[model samples]
Target: MFAPILMSSGVSIQLQAVDYLILAVYFAFVIGIGFALQRHTRTSDEFFLSGRSLPGWVTGLAFISANLGAQELIGMAASGAQYGIMTAHFYWVGAIPAMVFLGVFMMPMYYGSKARSVPEYLKLRFDERTRAFNSYSFAIMTISSSGISMHVLADLINRLIGWDYTLCLVVTSVIILLYVLKGGLTSAMYTEVLQFFMIVFGIAPLAWIALRDIGGWDGLVAKLTVTKPDALHSWAGTSGTENAMGVEWYGILIGLGFVLSFGYWCTNFAEVQRAMVAKDMGAARRTPIIGAIPKMLFPAVVILPGLVAFALTGDGQGYELPTKDGVPNYNQVLPSMLLHYFPSGMLGLALTALMASFMSGTAANVTAFNTVWTYDIYQSTIGRGKDDAHLLRMGKYATVFGILASMAFAFVAAQYNNILSILQLIFGFVNAPLFATFLLGMFTRRSSSRGAFTGLIIGTFAALLYHGFSHAVENPLGMKGGWLAQLLGQPAAFTLGTELAQTFWLATVAFSVTFLVNLIVSLVTGRDKTDAELSGLVYSLTPKPIETHEPFLLRPAVLGSLVLVVAIFLNWYFW
Candidate 1:
């Protein structure tokens, strides 16, 4: 399975017989575990939410592991090389706070309500219309995101190993489908736990080897001084666009940290659904806190390779990134580094790690999609009063549909040359306003379902307008799409420098508009809920929750606070 294969790039995939054996055994073991758990999924609860029987430690790791997919692995590393250590902002500032917020504040409402999915929570708090809107949007988003994973895997295989793209896609789909169909959410989480370790084992060594090759931390800094002085400093030039990222600290904090971060970690069902499966409220609240630790450190693991690739390529060390049509492929940096450094057996393991990341991400999307589809959409709308066993079957069928939908979207995503751009655009449109809806629903008893529905629709429309106007500058209509830009007139010369900054700005505007719209409309249009009605749903109306009997150190507040302090220290240190 791991025999050497020559590629168009002229480097051999030097995977030996033992390496192939390791991969074969790995796949078989994963499938065996899935089959072993097949009987546990007879009920909808088991099939969709792992019977809500997972411990914090297990669910916590799986929580972060599910997110360590192609986007995190590929896009983050590429950004590290392109934008430098400032990319760490995505984790340290952007993720940790929202994650802690989810664990400490939000999980209570989510888990206490015993809602089957995120959309269901909205339905309970708002109305069925709100729930349907969210569920439908999320279903489309999950399949699209999963398809991007499939497209990424096929593209990488074809480019790196001279494999047939369609064949690779079929193989990957079959593997993911089998385990997911057999074991449901339980199996997906179990495999995610395993994939988490594989990601560490796969990428940590590459960082070590690359750093050693460059001499050490000191050596890396010294070499980067000549090749990329800007990349060496994370925050020094972030105040303006004079450095690698060209994004201001205000943009980084408000745009990335508060808006985009909260939007994703708090509202995105693919992530929130993981915590919803915890055995109890305590475990559910602790899940993201536990997940936050590894999330904060992963930048060092994945980004280091990208930084190293930059150093090697800059130094003419035959580590140049692959190109298509004379444009350099930054996404290939990690794989290129793996090929440049690892040999034979190690190479195979690294490859397996990449594949593991892809599958883990894809599985999470598929599982989340199926759960929401079955409980939120199918059962609530089409198959009401269904038995548990029947719902379980529906969940299985939804999984297959999710996978197939993703496969179809993968082909659509392939037509676009820039996957990251499209991904960010989707996130901006869907997540930014969704967060606004949830924030109002949870914090204030006055925000009615009408307000939420209106806010979501208008907020998403605002995001689309921003995106349209931003790109409209190049259109023949010019600022016609955005009369405001036309009123100010176009600049003679300028550059935003990166798509991220643009997306950040767009999401920020959308979020602000949505929050205000929700607030004003909610205040004017409806009666507020009584404290009795708002008990566990609204923050101010709810009583302080009783503490769990777990040890002080293991307690959610203690751990979450500690994680926050560590995150603060990292920002300070990096700054």
Candidate 2:
């Protein structure tokens, strides 16, 4: 049988002096960039959006890096081990299309309108109430999400190095605070580009070593066919629960591929904010397209490690999930793989890459929250008529607050059994409703502020109800066992599994309800927005801008098409 992951197994690898040297060099270089850019971040716009002067390459790398948080690093690998290769769909299906759509269609309105933040765009298109609702909720979500990443970092360190979790949290938080306070978003983006390169170099070696040890892709597949038959197939048997992932084709296609995917890539400010900082319209539009290229291929590095682990551990090959008090800890797959495969020096680089992932994600959220708070909430309402310098001061202060608040949330996440489930529910509640509101506001001129706000409220309520229904069956929680069951006309035994499948369906239901409600309310309210008000904000009233100086290869149409073609091929090849 395979050994458990605890250090008691005597399998833990030790780091060499050279490994610590590499980590020291990386930290020095990253922090050095922050100090170098401190001069340029004197103004609010430069502090928050890099003075809107970043090249497509820099913004594009950072755009994807910001989203590759603890969840992407740890969760994707764990999913690959547990749910098999189908987890790759999160990239090829759930990300590529929406990214392409954003680049080719949505960037025109978002970048051309010159809105400093996503909530600002809502204010321009809708009303004050709409903007406030989005701004406040988004701020809270970003801080909470950032804290969870900090917690993940601490937990990983505790597992791998036997360090105190509290110490790990403090060390990581201080590093993030130092760079963000000095350089703002400008420093964050530059460092994110550097992290992106480091992450590839760090993980790619593990993947190569693992594949070689297992003989190769075909050999790994042959082994999995015996140990984990369903793990090798992506879409072959996804129509029902016969596959490793219990989701159906409709669930994958409509629930995930459409609702969840579009909701995240299109509406989430963390990713969109990177594109917003581009030097020009062409650069902004090309950001996601450039991101999509690397994004489509990253599964090979992150996801493959999980598969390698599963194959190696299963049927008594090597290391296995650690059992703490008789329950298996599956989340340690990636770290455990590094310990098993890499030696002393290389292990430090891999761990540093992991640290970079969490830090990049946390910084992105902090910067985004600060921007929204400084511009949308504080400036628009309380600090009206403030000078740019005054607003810049407020933004820096908000960044500090954001980092502190996130650290607090990281402690709170430790109280939960499965923090990712809570995060997913938050996404369902926020992104689904928010996307529905944005969709109606952008595509149609008739959507009223009152109607959009109503849809948002109803959509959120619908998501909560669905999540309650799904969980009530598995674990009874007061009303979910009694009142909620009666309301749904189903018994507590009718519970659904609270996985990606449930989250996707809940988001889908919320989107549908919000879209219908918005449509009905807008039609009844009649056209409230004049063409002048809708200029570059609404689809029909906006005229396409000419960008003839741009090369044909870099055009949104060409890049988006290439992205789609590659996505299609990946899905088919895996099928």
Candidate 3:
């Protein structure tokens, strides 16, 4: 029988001198970049949006790196192990198309309008109430996301190297705070580019070594098929709800692929802020499309190790998953793989890569948070007549507040086994409604501000109500849902077989309700902004972005189309 690796108050993995040296070098470089960029971030614009001066390639990598945090690394690996190959759908189906759409269709409106942030764009497009609602919701989401990254990194460090979890959290938070507070968004973006490369180089070799040990793809398939026949196929058994993921093709497409994916890539300020900093409209439009290329291939590095670990466990090879309460702690899959496969020098690089990822994510959130709080909330409300100098000062202060707030939320993140599920639930409440509001506001000028604001309120509540009444079969109480059902002394309205399914369906409910309610209210309330006022904000009134001077290959439409084709081919190949 296989035994799980139980957590103890002792160090599990030891580092050699070379490992310590590598780690020291990485920390030095990280802090050095912040000080190097400090001279350029003197103004509010430079501090908040990098002075709109970065190249497409830099912003593009940062765009994806900002997202490759605990969610992509730890949560994805956990999903890969638990749900099998179907987890790739998160990238191949849910992310790529939305990224292409953002590049080809949405960037013109966002970059053309001169809005500093996404919530500010809403203010320009609709009204103050609509922008306020989005700004506060977005602020909450960013803090929560940053906290999740912090929690996961601390947990990994505690598990592998036996550091005190609280110490790990405080130390990492301080490092991120110092860098972001010094150089601002410019610092965050440049370091994100560095982190992107570190993550790729650090983790790719582990996947290669794992595959080699398993005798390659065919060998992995042979082993998994014996225990999980559907693990090797992405969409083979997804037609119904009996699959490993407990989601049907429709749920995967509509809930994750359409609603959740579009909601996030199109509306979230953290990712969009990366593209907004590009030097020109052309570059801005290409940012997400460029990021799509690497995003399509990331599953191999991040997800494959989890699948390999699952296959190796309990096969009499003396490997087992770390366990909590006698259940597999899938969150440790990536760190576990790093500890198992890498030597001292390599382990340092891998750990630095993980640190880079967490920092990248946290910095993105903090920068976006500070911008929205300074411009959208503070400047708009309390500090209406503040000069640029004052606003810039406040932005730095907000950065400090954002990191502290994220630290507080880190403890909240510790309650969940798979961080992705909790994140999706948050997105279901926040992004799902926001996407509906953006869709109506951008595509047509008929959406009234009151209608949009009301829709967001009702839509957010609808998601909460649905989640409260729904439960995953295995996890039926509290964070996973069913609390309201318990309060009502009745069974859950919906019982999903998996936590992933429940979150997906909750997003679907939120989007559907928000869309319908917004449409109806807009029809009733009539147009709030006239055609002249909606110029550059609404798609129909905005001038078509011309790319005749650029090379055909560099055009956003061409690049977006090519990305879609490759995404389709990938889905077909994996199918």
Candidate 4:
């Protein structure tokens, strides 16, 4: 009778024109900063790379903003609602090591190269087809991802502020795009610092209140264990194949580390834009890790309150799952939890934090997409004939275009309920070959142009087919079949066929086959290109200065490993 998220549960925090006015004003200020920075962005270099003058914190904050898209803010909480501590490993175990790897080995190569774009570097080392192929493929993913981002901010705002959902989406998106178009990356970076602070300040109190509401640490744990032991630690306690709790170790190592990290952090143009804008090589070098350090702790800060909500709502349950809306949806963990636990005025603040979390992602994506279209697709392609003045005008226009694209995507993305799952579907096809092609291009001088080109084409296509085919298997009847079907797994979740099947298996198959296919092609083609030519392409970028000592890597590595070990111990202990 008492659903935690029922319509009548709390006083509706009806939004006023003043609310929209305040948000609009903030949007104007962000856009004003961008327009003011146009003077600094006179050349293609400045427009694309912030003229390469950003400092450690500037680039570092933007780097964090780039990765902290709406999918992450909402998805982390969603995963927690279902999975538990095992969910946190996505960052602590997966992203941190990838960050450390980037700082020690990859960052040097990236900054050292002097290449404008990732694909440009590929072209230099391999072939034009490789460069063009990567450029376009990445562009599509970034746009789709960015557009979906707008909906996230809009969705959270609507839920938090109690406004018409469409109105919230429109108002939030229009404001964000205005600033993004105005100053481009400059405004985006500055705002990210404020956004990050806002998110932390907003979320911290709610978490404290939840813990206090349960009485204390002991009370909180005791209450949660009694209410939902499945959410307590392992998140790995799924009874059988349909279990959301049962993430395997092999999947963790590959799914997150090799595929996701390299895909998001390393190859993403949005992420690369952060490094490219850095003031110097030194700033660029350390900023990624500096940025990464806080992100590792994010799940703890963001997901804790949701667990508390589950603890409070149990038995016949206050709110089972969001069945009122649809099937097995997990996106409600934050909004539903906040509404139940936080008081009135504080609810507004919590709402702002969720909006800020989303805006950070929206603003970051808008800035990067503006840079990409202006630099890669538009300036390099369609508007190639224009002068500097014309190109600059066109560049600002590109931001507007990107904003519209994102708005469109947000509307369409509603059909799919799981934001993270949809994103992973896209990543399945593109992320692996992206990691492999770039890695080989940098480290191995023996790799050939034909090999690199063929590898990318073969790998990406294979991954796409793997995803489509696997999904087909997942629902031979169709995906509409709900949790009962999922548990029974008509097609199963992880396997082609089994006690279970997951989306991960196809990704793994795609990754292995593509890599092997590309590797063989590279070797066969290596004979045509002399070793010197290969090495030249590989080392064409200015080499980063090496210090044999890296005391920093040890701590993250140790910390990351400790988290993994403890996770396995807990899963085993609980089982």
1-575: candidate 3 lDDT, tens digit per residue: 21223353322677678877877888788888888888988999989988999999999999999998889988888888887888899999999999999999899999999999999999998889889999999999999999998988888788777789999989888888888877899889888999999989889999899888888988889889898878788899987898988999999999999999999999999999999889999999999999999999999988898998888888667456666666677877777777777877888899889888998899899999999999999999999999999999999899999999998999987876568888888888999999999999999889988889889999999999998999999885665798899888899988998888898999999998999999999999888778999999999999999899999999999999999999899888878
For all candidates in order, the CA lDDT equals 0.83, 0.84, 0.89, 0.64
Model with the higher lDDT, candidate 1 or 2: 2
Candidate 3 lDDT at 349 equals 92
Q: Of 2 and 3, which scores higher on TM-score?
A: 3
* Best TM-score among the predictions, by candidate number: 3
Taking every candidate in turn, the Cα RMSD to the unseen true structure, in Å, is 3.2, 2.7, 2.3, 5.0
Q: Please state the error at residue 137 of candidate 2 in Å.
A: 0.8
TM-score comparison, 1 vs 3, better candidate = 3
**Candidate 3 positional error at 242, Å:** 1.1
User: What's the alpha carbon RMSD for model 1?
Assistant: 3.2
TM-score of candidate 3 versus the correct structure, residues matched by position: 0.97
Candidate 2: list runs displaced more than 4 Å: 1-5, 8-13, 319-328, 472-494
**TM-score for all predictions?**
0.94, 0.95, 0.97, 0.84
* Residue 328, model 1: Cα distance from true site in angstroms: 3.3
Give lDDT tens digits, candidate 4, residues 1-575. Answer: 32233543322345445545545555565667767775775665666666788877777766776677777767887777666655666676556666656654566666766767666667667776777787777767777787677777666666555567778767777767666655556767777876776677667776788778767778867876776666665435433433443445565556665666666677776777677667766677766766765776576677776666556555454434443334435677677666666555555555665676677687677666666566566656777778876766776787777777877888888666667766776666677777777777777666667777777777777665545334433344344223333445554232343211344554566567666766788787664555555543454433445544545443334434554455445346534
Best by lDDT: 3
lDDT of 2 by residue, 80-145 (tens): 888788989899998999999988888889998999999999999998888999999899999998
**Candidate order (TM-score):** 3, 2, 1, 4
Q: Model 2 RMSD to the real structure?
A: 2.7
